[model samples]
Target: MRRIRRMLVPAFAMALVFPAVLPAQAAPIRATVKSIEFEGMAAPASVKEMADQYSTASLKVTYSDGSVKTFPLSYNRLFKTTDSIGGTVAGVAIDHKGAPIIDNSVPANPTPYVSDSPDSNSLFQVPGMAPSALGGNALSLVTHYEYITFDNANQSAYGLIPASMSLTTLDQNKQTGELKPTELNKIDFSGVNGLWIPCNGSLSPWNTHLGSEEYDPDARAYEADPKATFISPFVQAYYQDKTKTGNPYDYGYIVEVKANADKSTQVAKHYSMGRFSHELTKIAPDGKTALFGDDGGNTMLFLYVADKAQDLSSGTLYAAKWVQKSAANGGSADLQWIKLGHGTDAELKVLVDKGLRFSDIFETSDKAAEGFTAIKTYPSGKIEYLKVKPGMEKAAAFLESRRYGAMLGATSEFNKMEGVTINEKDRKAYVAMSYVEKAMEKDAKGADPADDIQVDKISSGVTYELDLAGGAKDRDGSAIDSAYVPTFMSGLVVGEDLAKADALGNKAAVDKVANPDNLSYSESLRTLFIGEDSGMHVNNYLWAYNVDTHKLSRIMSVPAGAEATGLQFVEDLNGFSYIMSNFQHPGDELLLPDPLKIEVLAEINKSFENRKAGGVGYISGLPSMKQIVEAAPVIGDDNPTDKSLVDLRAKAAAAGAKLEWHGKNKDIVVTLGKHSLTTRVDSSTATIDGKKVNLPAATQFSKGKTYFSAAIWDQFIKL
Candidate 1:
């Protein structure tokens, strides 16, 4: 079934009214500006090395005054070996001591974050500038959380493996959004016990990088068997100390990294935000309210509202209870938040430094014992018997949050809750469900707690839309501090599973998304972009869905067995448009032990090229931002269409200027209204009455009339 939507007007132009009907085509093959439309390159062939193929995109923008301008952009992949066509190239790995893993004679060190590992989240900085700004460009810092670290040193649990996070300085051509790498440095993570699979990330409201550590080794599982170094190779490699188990509590929190003016970084692990497979965190406009998605089966959703603005060091954490309202199509539910004990990062870090154990915070049993809470399935689909010990609730909330929330009755019914992004203009948020099976569906094995999310299994997965609102009171009747509180969630896009596999061994529909991962939204464009991390598709795709039009367009696709990630949009970067994305683990085997995996691997081998380094890239355009602001007055609009014989008075208003004409002909008196008498307009020169000025353009007229010429106006704005 097709979903219909209304025009999501941008905040900048609330007064502008759109037509009653928008374009009906889901996605077109052409680009048009009158109405927003962009049909990117054709999808790659099934068994092709599609990574080498490039695409072109066009974006037509409509301004507050109803002026229209179109921007054309080029899309391509980036590697250490490749020079950036538009922006900075990524894919370099560094050690804790800040040395490149592999030598780079080339500008971009091709050593992937961890050799042969996937490069995860990418953040491209573009700060808004003032109108009167002059000279110089603002250096944009491109940051990436290298997913994992490995080299010749170690590939197994017993070997030494420490990951890295890199920050690259890219001086931008604001007018074009083109970038040139200036300096590259690694953000040291030794202070935080090192990052574990630093996965997805989001830009904080105050312009910092908010990232996560995903799929941390189970803390309780480690407690049961201390010798199981295979369970946590990261701990064994990073810590290596027989005396220290390497605190599991330290490895799964929101890690914040800030790059300073000197290319130095400030790194902090926000332990107050709860520990789990934190896929990512998105901060609302208020800055205090943060929504974090846990990536695993039977997971929980968490919300953290900071005690103060722009500070994640301390916050009040809340877990979600899925109050199912429907059973069909991945299930619709009203979210009820459970208040969990809060702690500051400073306090939580102390407990972690003391090497707190799972037994210290919670008591467990195979079956329900006296004072023990009922057994609840963990996010990994394993049933866990948990009972938060008295005086340890605060510790459990930060150390073993998913278990603590489940003990408190917050529903752990979600599966593969991956990525999240908010559309403040629409007061809505989007979440990616990589898979929609397991605990979310009916249980075959008998269980104690009831299944709140009993629904059909979806191998391809579902993407949910959550409604955000203000003035939402909590379960305890106290007002939630966040204005952007999520109230309900429903499947906005559901992927269909086919009984028969496709020609390329794809189990899901090609048109619809399979295993949607990173989600990013552009408020100005009213578009939600999605990336895929799927085993169902032989080749994963990147998509752009117009919220106002409800048209989902397959914009680009990656090579076979690759995970498309970090789909972010910059609607206006100094009047230029940018849509950035990156893919990783190309040519890897499709996840499984099935015969179909063998067949798919054989087909992928035909066009796939294996690389020792991870893949990191983006799609972009470049114009001089410094040039745009300087030319605003003379150009009027970004793409000015002033007539050949434009009237002097009419041209001034179009140039965003306010000027009054008192006299006409050779006796013309032009005043800025503030000046009693400034200058008089002549046939080709300005005569100073009170102020002296120069008129560069001579008078020209169409149909025997005299006015200013439109030619050469591209570089001037008469202030």
Candidate 2:
């Protein structure tokens, strides 16, 4: 669904007011912005502007003094100020020079601190810190705890069934209304493969999540094709089986997990989709054909799986073929399906043994060329794994002597391919890529070719939209749609005009591309959201492109530390809109021989006959929040310290607390443990600096512990 951005509301002379029919508010909750306090600086001037753009109403922020400031609220989740009292903030604001700003202010431990201004460059210096504002304390760094949610019948384990519920609301706490928390439904999804990276992925037409594994697999020679050495990294399988290496190559392949299960043992693999680094998947509006992108650094290709569900076993996979030299050229490509017709099991075994590396021949030809390059080899790129093997003690030695060109392998036509989407209304497939500046070296100037690629190189994420006409046909020896193609083969086409137009489109696209990182279509919101990857130290952001406006603007950044990865628009039990992040949780596990497997036939048989008689045989998009919330008790503080409350209140104050840097080094430290105050319960009286002050129960305390650091300053007392 396309999410309507507030900006698209053309400044109407009159505002339309519908009846106050907010989806039934199950709770008596209200968000009131009490007051605003500034530390080093006053509220940003843009705060008011932001409120006007996204907030439901102008925020009335009263200061300790008699002054007041007003501003608009951000409609986007990344920008929305809600229930959370303390969390890292990362996102692009109109104010921060279009760079992501990270605010790590927590009220419980208020210590005003200032650090270096990070851009795209210094972000990755700290492993977990690169994505979020906090240098080391990122959310993805936390362990993936097994959490359960409530279902209509009872509690069910996650990954046991594809959750098919519409989300009603997303509170500030980050919990959705329908998917409830419970204990009985605990299930381990990390069978063997490990915790899947939370790249907010897409639900395919066939009900499978297009999740991408983020780990670089232990190198192995899975495909022994002497003809090919490199392979796209995506593969199909539940990450249950552990190997000396890891779950197959990072190459792209579709893995299906069936839902509507009666018993376990439902997961299965459909090896038809070709291998490549996959970002996301989208099917034609008709739901028969599928399109995906190869997000590898080398020349990547766009893949098509025709009739994927029923007969992808022998269908075509095509790469876009752009015309080389045509002024009238629109950068479009004739779909060229790879020519590896269904091979014998022996040939398939040979292809697999040759190492999943794509054929070097295909790489050499299309890597450097623009539109409609002929595919004489398997994958049109270089195979870099020919020299490296998992157990080879001499693998490093073999790599050192190899020619750089040979080692570097063939280049495909694109840079870093990322997101994929289909404009079914227009019958077009859109492939997106992150544009890397070719001129920049790893170091700023000449430190070292191998130094970490510097922070800034000018990145603009772009998308390519293709038209699949003539039944995926193109001239110039490019393969058109055909069933007798290899899983990774590009479809061949036969129209000179198609090739020329496709090439022209590819070139033109480079100029028009924007820096938007991730893309997804919201069936409910009826909009497309583009997310930014954490580039350099810049915080990744979320941007929404209004189909009506045709202009994209910064919506919000994902919370600090979690680089926006996969995006799927999900409806909650309350029918609210939510975008899930396929976060790469650190402690996620990979177990062997996953035990929760469901038998697909067993489950389907029970539902099939009833479903045939109009039972619908499916899970509802809406969930029962009452049952979920009931199962989940109001969690009390886990800390033994009643001081937890003290810390919470103190931290809340600190969040609004502001202090300027005072140290000569611009590095100052503030300690909370150093200060001790006494407070009464009823007509509370607190002594600060030996002075007595009356405090109300409502008065937020400023004491927690006694520890502060060189980086913090003073805390604001929110009396």
Off by over 4 Å in 2: 1-179, 183-200, 214-252, 261-265, 306-314, 324-411, 439-458, 474-514, 523-526, 560-562, 571-576, 581-719
- Per-residue alpha-carbon lDDT of candidate 1 for residues 1-719, written as tens digits (9 for 90 to 100): 00001011222222222232334331211111124444555556533344332445554444332345444556654444223323422343444444444422244534433433434444445345321122335454444534432333334211134555667655555454555555555678877777776678887878788878777567777787855433354554445433545656768778888766555778999989888888889999998999987877668888888999999999888988888888677778898888887789999889988988888888778876788776464533566667777899889888778878888888887878888999997799999888888778877665647577777788788889999999987777777888899999998877888898876667898888888888888765567888888888777887777777776777667766666766666555545555566665555555423565555455544433333334555666422222222222222223334334356566556755455555544344434322221233334433322222234554554554447645323222322
Error of 1 at 320 (Å): 0.7
Tens-digit lDDT track of model 2 for 622-673: 2222221222211111112222123433343565532223445432222233
Give the clash count for each candidate: 12, 144
Lowest summed lDDT window (length 10), candidate 1: 1-10
> What is the Cα-based lDDT of residue 604 in candidate 1?
45
Candidate 1 off by > 4 Å: 1-34, 46-53, 60-72, 81-96, 99-113, 118-138, 145-160, 229-232, 239-244, 377-380, 444-448, 590-609, 621-719
Residue 228's lDDT within candidate 2 is 29
Cα RMSD (angstroms) for every candidate in the order listed: 10.0, 25.8
For candidate 2, the TM-score is: 0.42
* lDDT values for all models: 0.63, 0.29
- Which candidate leads in TM-score? 1
